[model samples]
Target: MRRSRAADPRGRAADRGSRTVTLTGLVAATALTASLTAACGGGTSTDTEGGNTDPKTLTYWATNQGASLEHDKKVLTPELKKFERQTGIKVKLEVIPWSDLLNRILAATTSGQGPDVLNIGNTWSASLQATGALLPFDDKTFAKIGGKDRFVPSALASTGTAGKDPAAVPLYSLAYGLYYNKARFDEAGIDEPPATWSELVAAGRKLTKGGKYGLAVEGANLAENSHHAFVFSQQHGGDFFDSEGKPTFTTAANVKAVKQYVDLLAGDKIAAPGNAEYAQNQSLKDFATGKAAMLLWQAADTTLKSHGMKPGDYGIAPVPVQSGAPGQGRNVNSMVAGINISVFKNSDNLDGALKFVKFMTSDTEQKHLNSTYGAIPPVKSAQDGGTFSTPAQKVLRETLATSAAPLPQVPDESKFETLVGTAMKELFADAAAGRQVTEKSVRDRLAKAQQQMQS
Candidate 1:
């Protein structure tokens, strides 16, 4: 169900430099604080009434999404209230910035003091599971969430173990795709989005005249750079890792894709030179400001519209495919993305924690989340909600229908992405400096990656 090949442990957006979380939250319940601290020790002691003293209270930690998540909290709070009223339990929720979330979780896990239920990057599931701090999803737990069948198989796949019990339920799912500026396309006389790698190159070149860039891609950030390169590599028939979770980025397809990825900015001259130094914000700003005609982006169309761009001013499409490959129509690999839900093993409220997990990932909650934040719903049924306030959502959804594989799901994924990004940076830099993009140069760069993999 998780689309094994696409289960990239290094592929999620946070690592890719996509969005940053600016946290804004406060709780007015003193008694609740006391109960929580008392129940989960190992932190600076503080005195607050009812200090998590009650065993019936459940604490939840959610990563920052858009303001819509606050709305979700509002809806969920009432639902929790009803549950608590019936069961004589209390629910405490906290929202934290996504940037340092993993570090926070790791620290909390080590100290034995953290939320009972928490949201995490799906790719981090394996690493976190290694800590033995997560509760396995058994048959009883699965039933609490209306069965796993309600969610998209691919989304759920990323959340749990392939053969054993799952560590987490798929909360939401996302994929990457090409986002283009309609105004730029129209002005360039381009009528349709590119459908093949060849077309993409041609369109990019045509749109590159003038100071405007044809594409805006992040080249420095490991995840962003590697994901873009992965799409091209997969389209050309490259597989970055093997069944044993080993590095395999030096394949012929990878060589070709890497060349093309670099050429977009250096050889083809369709992308901005500054792209190598930019992250997600810079790329989005480039497209929004009309400095670039296209970019590979994740999530729904809400962010674009939020920038004051009209829906008709832009378009969405799947990453173009190579001429021939095993899955030509779906040759391109969009990074499988989304956060994972995990519970600390040391939590005293394991039962309450599991209940909250089931509630958050229920079919109903997924639909509302998808609708609220334009997040791709892990539940196939929930994915039917209204696309972002734009037709672009439909196009993006259609593109994702091919379901490009998730990124690598190895525990050492973060390190691998950095290696890929380093190779790309060197490749792009070499091309820009007038070096021949021969197989030798690529081989040399990849050799470094191979060496690192071995170490």
Candidate 2:
């Protein structure tokens, strides 16, 4: 969800507090993103046994955030400098925005000019792995990085596998939830945020008023929009994919959920006007500014701070579900999200890069990442010690307790999400226009997308 950017005095003070805590947290977190002093178990250098001649140097590329290279260098340069002092190796670092990352990687693969090590979004693991552009890490490589046992199984599972080889190592993790404005709820006479789909709609109706939307969303965000749709489907005991990983989103439960998704803007009239046109960040912006009362988004605690909202002013809960579902399933499904670090197949500094990846995923480093970047740790132990250290953390931790599932980990995931979302958008527009959504339309649309996925 987007965070509201209102200039509340108390909210401003809360923002300062968040920054202070984050700065203090970075001392511990920066370790995950920074330097590596320990040796990796798989220590074969192309410079030696692999018939290569070059100085011992490693190049790293990452999407910028958490800390910029300038700030990262302050923390990591010292660590790399120390590694050089101890191991006689040098490291170079570069940052790229996410928008250009994929094209750049594809270009590098074609030109044979890719960095020795690359940080990738977890969602892209399967796609990149399919290209055979990354070196698959074997047991020996895991042992070098302190083994698979050191990381969270969920994070480890996100990286693709070709047989026994791991395509990448997770660097951080994310999950989505509902972020509500506490003051708005109070004003609307809502004692607590709704816990079921029916109650949520009721709450939205009560809260929306002149010039304010009860909820904010961006139907145009095809990839992200699917996250909400899937979550609602799960809450209603539905599946977007059959056991064979084929599309099955036309189920009755799913149709109902899709109607709910559209009803926020259409029937209820509680969503921002022109919401269908907003992009990913716009909803977040609307929510942060108090233009919307509720939002469904991922790991927004940091952004909440930027929008001048605080923990007390905001309440986060698991995504609400159908009135009565099995497991008292109040929460919808969630996906594990994060970035993964991997070595390029043709990297000359394999040993150095592998060592660096391990250092980043280690418990100590994971702790640093949690503290510094406000990102969840990919290592289970490190996450336990990290920033999600309060009752507020429980809100997220518990929400994920529901059987949250991820998008299909397939090479065509991006295309699949796009197709599914495009179909959903058309149906959603109908739902918004007060047309009764039915199983026929949902099923027909899904079947077409499924066929396209197979093709």
Instruction: Determine which window of 10 residues in candidate 1 has minimal summed lDDT.
Output: 22-31
Error of 1 at 282 (Å): 1.8
Q: What is the lDDT of residue 276 in candidate 1?
A: 70
In model 2, the runs with Cα more than 4 Å from the true position are 1-55, 64-90, 161-164, 249-254, 324-332, 425-448
Location of the lowest summed lDDT over 10 successive residues in candidate 2: 3-12
Residues 1-455, model 1: lDDT tens digits: 01111122222421123322111110111001212222242222233331233458777776554424464466456767766885676877776544445556655654556777777667656545544567667777778767867766666656644676777777656666677888888888999888776788889888887788888866654455666666777676676888887888788877777877777877787888778776434566677778888877665344555466665777777666676345463465576666667765556666566666666676676666656555666767666645533565565455455645656555545455556767887777676566777777887887787677566
Per-residue CA lDDT of candidate 2, range 1-455, in tens? Answer: 00000000000000101101111121222112112212221223434343223436777775443223354445456656655675676777776544345556666665556677877666556656666767787888888888888776665666773344678886756555678998889888899877776788889888788788789876655545555666677777676767655666667876776666766776677886577776435676688788899987655655566567676878777667677445554345465555677887666566677777776677776676555544566676776743667655566556434444544565654444456666666766666556755667666777776676556
Predicted structure 1: lDDT = 0.61
lDDT score at residue 168, model 1, on the 0-100 scale: 79
Give per-residue lDDT, candidate 2, residue 31.
19
Candidate 2: residue 118 Cα off by (Å): 2.1
